[model samples]
Target: MNLGIIGQAAGLYAVTNIDDILVLALFFAQGAGHKNSTRNIALGQFLGFAAILAVAVAAAYGATFLPGSAVPYLGLLPLALGTKAAVQAWRHRGDAEEEKQAGEGGPKPLEVAAVTFANGGDNIGVYVPVFATAGIGGMSAYVIVFLALLAVWIAAGRYFATRPVIAKALSRWGHILLPLVLIGIGVLILIEGGAFGL
Candidate 1:
């Protein structure tokens, strides 16, 4: 429970995850009308982040289970998701009934989780060294702080999504923008990770 450790963990998480706010905001906007949207998003975020942390911890402990070269392949998850969304949007274009039906269901938890995990490739890279240097006690503290901050991140994203200007824009264009955003993120991840030589 060292204050320094807590601060360090918080700073690290903040630095690594600032981009998540926009992603979560898009998710919130897309899920606005669904009954279980918030719950699903939160659950998916936690599950996905947990997986990232697990891998970082395992890698820190010298588990070579997942090689660095394979990290870029994670980009395919978001790429596939974006492609699916684009196809759905194209198919439902200009059909109010079909578009409404498509929008009603919101995103699935696994879909959110997959996106979160796919987007966390850099997080894993940043965390592995930190976890390696941190002893058991320090690692525990970091994990606790990271999880708590994730809740805060989700809240911030929801807040941003609810702002009148943002909300209106998202309501109007989120479907189209979401797919492009996802695709862009996927490409960025792939290029950065050198997946398939970009």
Candidate 2:
């Protein structure tokens, strides 16, 4: 395991994923008053990121077998998800608290995971190339570091949620911001990947 490579991969992932902080803060805020909410968020995030890694690694190995043209179309997953979110947000524009209270009824673990996965279209794009060149040992190191950083990310989100000011702000604006972020991510993926020839 190369310490430098691990650190580099971890840093790259962390730095490039600043939007995750806001999304996580939203999750933490939504999970308020629920005992296992944090656990659910952490687990969902892990599942989502693990899925990204799996897809990336698979793409790397399947290069010879899979048609490269088909890969970019994966952007559709996030594009559709984001459009749904935006519509939901727009419908609830006048009732933020009501929408939140409704959502607070349960821990939407799968929802979070799905959004995380969809929002990670860019991560998939970035990771595929990186993992392609990494040998088995380097891949293992990257995985280790990524999992470790995931924990820190969860902790940071939870911590931020505990702060009254931050939590309040997130609760008030997260619904609006999340949809935009998701849509932007989706569009960026489509444009960059040139899905369907743009």
- Candidate 2: tens digits of C-alpha lDDT, residues 1-198: 777897788787887667787778877876777678888888888888888778888877764333656555655665676677667667766765866557445335676677677667567767777777887778778878888888888888889988989878867776666566666766776777798678
Residue 137 miss distance in model 2 (angstroms): 1.6
- C-alpha lDDT of residue 124 in model 2: 70
Clashing residue pairs in candidate 2, if any?
A: none
What overall lDDT goes with each candidate model? Answer: 0.89, 0.73
TM-score top scorer: 1
Q: What is the TM-score of each candidate against the true structure?
A: 0.95, 0.78
When summed lDDT is taken over every stretch of 10 residues in candidate 1, the lowest stretch is 95-104
**Residues forming the 10-long window of minimal summed lDDT in candidate 2:** 63-72
C-alpha-based local distance difference test score of model 1 = 0.89
Error of 2 at 65 (Å): 8.9
